[model samples]
Target: MSSFDLRLLLDPPRYPANRYAPLADRIKRLLATHANVVFVQAEAILALEAVAISIARPGRVAVNVVTSPYGAWFGTWLSRGGAGVHQVSAAPGQPIDAAAVSACLERLPQVDIIAAVHAESSNGALNPLAELAALARSRDALFVVDAVASVGGHPIDFDQHGIDIAVIGAQKALAGPAGVSGVAVSARAWAHIAASPDVAPSSLSLMDLKRNWLERGRLALPGMPPPLEFWALEAALDRVEAEGIEHVIARHRQAARASRAGLRALGIEPWIARDEAASALVTSAPVPTGVDAHTLIADAARMGVELAPGYGEIEGRLVRLDHTGTRAKFDAVLANVTAYGTALERQRVDVDIGAAARAVNDVYAAR
Candidate 1:
């Protein structure tokens, strides 16, 4: 490679001190909160683990919700930290039911913390965040939400929902790099972390991150941070600001409607039956009989359209059509439905490509 290329890729300018505070401030603004914001130098999983480590201590009762794999991992993390975790699980390919959560909270009224995923992209289901948050409030528990797949695509008011800790990833609905992530922590959460004797001052400690922000005040990070990813996140936030957040959310919702309508027109059923419970970030559809989800994904890719198979155990049973960030567009919806229809036809399945395309167009037109 040329020297210019090497320097451009390897020696990007360092993040300026003045921009650090603004970056954190912008994230707080995006979440529509005055809560403390800490930008993690790693993926959102690390930020969430930090929250778990800070909150889960011996003798604490935490209700860990398991609607997706991430929730399951959080439950395991809490258990490893000596917290008594009561996992409330939803049926496969379904969002967590408010009634079940209410029952769990009622049974464990002494719970100190509640952890849940706002949207399960794996199954394209949106959990009842408002109801769950209300339950946490009733129990006086710290509400922790994994908003990785919901932010930017769905409406979120951290303070309004009484969310003590919310972890977000730039890679999903934010349309940014996976290398950077963040968390918004409420005063109640900070207090919980400060009181935890087991909470250590480490790289993965949320307390350490909060200290860095308070002590450093508008200065750049203590160590060398990833300039590229930070700048990319800034650019992504700029885009969001340019197109109004509400409009961005509406676009995502519209894309999901178009994708679902198109799929239904092709005789494919959505994994989530209720529109209100489905995630706008992604639309999951079951693979038709005699057809492998992987094969369909491969066929779609060959036609210049990429589709993701359902995560983990659900793989090969369903296909996920992404509608988050840049993918939440009319063009993307059309391309995805057309690809699915064409792939079905290639497999000797009777699919009306014209009808599916028209359905998608109709949805967009209605929007």
Candidate 2:
């Protein structure tokens, strides 16, 4: 038998039930939001769905931006909640154009809510958040953002941006457990959510979280909370504070910058060519023709670098270099680029691996 007890992994630490509210507050501060914060026991997607179901009603009109599967699923949730949906879809894994959204809004429909993703990790696309917010404000509509991928990598001044409902997850840039997530809801959003006659009554209900948790002194959650996830989340918050949030964000940006530079030196093009439209969370590029992405990424993993393929519809078509939380460092960035270049070499692709390594080194040295 191994010296370490196996049971320890199952019961490492116990998270205090009462501290869940305080943990939620910590996430609120991370978001820089003044909105009412609700901690959900499930992952971010459920929190997103609850937000949509809460705001959607039969008479409501929503302009939903579809850039990836996550945004598409959000629109489905709104539709299921009886909202009249006007979808502004882009090419798969592409950011929605602000002009397209405005043109859609000008079609004489009174939009009650505007739903979009802040950044899409699937193809490293960063949506036009400010422009989308401005369009929503012009129509006097509630702006809902799924910031699952952008929270720590990008600055989110939630209240300052007038975001009515912003959904966040800990797994992406926060480097926390995937099981626990939170949402920030503004007063205007509450008014709309409270008006929904069919607001979810069970766990996927934001209104209940507000009434049962937020208004009731922010103690324990209504349902049984996941203790391990809460404990891990607390640790993540502590780590962020220790590292300084600004430094953490800067690291992700630096990693992205280096990865992009290295990719260019190797003759690989970023999927989102425009730096302005790409997210710092991950650097993505189309998979080289005839190269199996899974095999390439798996090969990279053997070299001590973690690489991922695109999600859903874009799977196998793109390869991504993640720079999330702890991995957003010069070493990680260099290793990622080097491993990919080497993996490509193994596939008989002529790549300038030496130049790519130099490019990554130059970026960090200059910084």
Candidate 3:
């Protein structure tokens, strides 16, 4: 396909395979390309619900390694699903190390499933899944990962990393709408789900969805799928495939590097510690002295640049810089930095505008 026609692939159209056949097929293709992987599309929270149900047993425990708000929420979901939830805590801006997880499991012998976030978009921390997955494997526990903000923008090797179940969302890195997200399930995860006697909501049940849509060769129930979002996701996936996942990941890494360099040049330190920093997306420096993060973001918006404020408690204290999806470009990076510099200047925060731009330029030039 030519560059011009790339956009055409994103167009939504009903196909004979099923109402949501195109999306299901796309996800299946992604999973089938990787050994021992199964793909299910649902909100990340819903996916976690399934994972909780799939893995929960009468006496087994599910351990959630919390490094972000999402992890805490998932832990609650696991607990509500009848699994004993063990929270292994890590400070914000840092990741839960594999050794820490291993220690937790060692202390809690009943732990059967290990859940963690691959990238905590809330704090811009990237967990070391490969290492953690190995640790989980050593303990013979199912490794469940939340890759919501990492999948399209970072490197994730389900088979190589030994991740039994990895959840992804559309809005963050895929550059798609929020309603559609997906989860990749390993054979082990499927087995866990299959063995469970707990009844699942028909639409929310991973096993039911798999049976109807995948094994039984039936379309999803009417009014049960997000057609446009699915098409958009397929389009996004096609773009990723064309560009190559490695190249996509490298681009995000480069953009993140440029963002950090620019921020540092402007005398801004990232909220996240250097060791656990994520390349998929960036969280802003803590609110500068005498300046509010909300004001900075508002100023950027006035300058025609959109930036997200930190969610929950961090709101107005930090900003989030997303370098993913269709907007992952050097020009986009330059524009964002320029807008930020402008905003800071307006707020009377000490900022060397030229230097920040130059720092980003240097990274782009080197690339």
Query: Scored by CA lDDT, what does every candidate get?
Result: 0.86, 0.87, 0.72
lDDT for 76 in candidate 2 is 96
What is the clash tally of candidate 3? 0
Which pairs clash (backbone N, Cα, C closer than 3 Å) in model 1?
none
Q: What value of lDDT does candidate 1 attain over all alpha carbons?
A: 0.86
lDDT comparing candidate 3 with the true structure: 0.72
Residue pairs with backbone overlap in model 3: none
TM-score of 2: 0.95
What is candidate 3's TM-score against the reference? 0.87
Q: What's the residue-level lDDT of 3 in candidate 3?
A: 59
User: Could you tell me every candidate's TM-score relative to the true structure?
Assistant: 0.96, 0.95, 0.87
How many residue pairs collide in each prediction?
0, 0, 0
lDDT of 2 by residue, 1-367 (tens): 7899877659656577688767777878888876778888888888888888788889899999998999989999999989999999987777889999999999946899999999887778899999999999999999999999898889888977889989999898888889988888899988888888655477767888888878888877787777788888898989888987788888888899999999999988888888888899899877899898988988998998878888878898888898887788888888888899999889988889999999999999997
Model 1 ranges off by over 4 Å: 1-7
Please give, for residues 1-367, the per-residue lDDT of candidate 1 as tens digits: 5556555567678778789788888888778889988888888888888888888888999998888788999999888878999999988778998888888877864889989999887889899889999999989999999999899889889988889899999888889889889899999898998887545457678877777765668476755689999888898989988998889889989999999999889877788988999999999888888997778999999999888888866788888888888999989989988898898788888988898999999998885
Which regions in candidate 3 have their CA more than 4 angstroms from the true location? 1-13, 18-42, 217-223
In the order shown, the candidates' Cα RMSDs to the true structure are 2.1, 1.9, 4.4
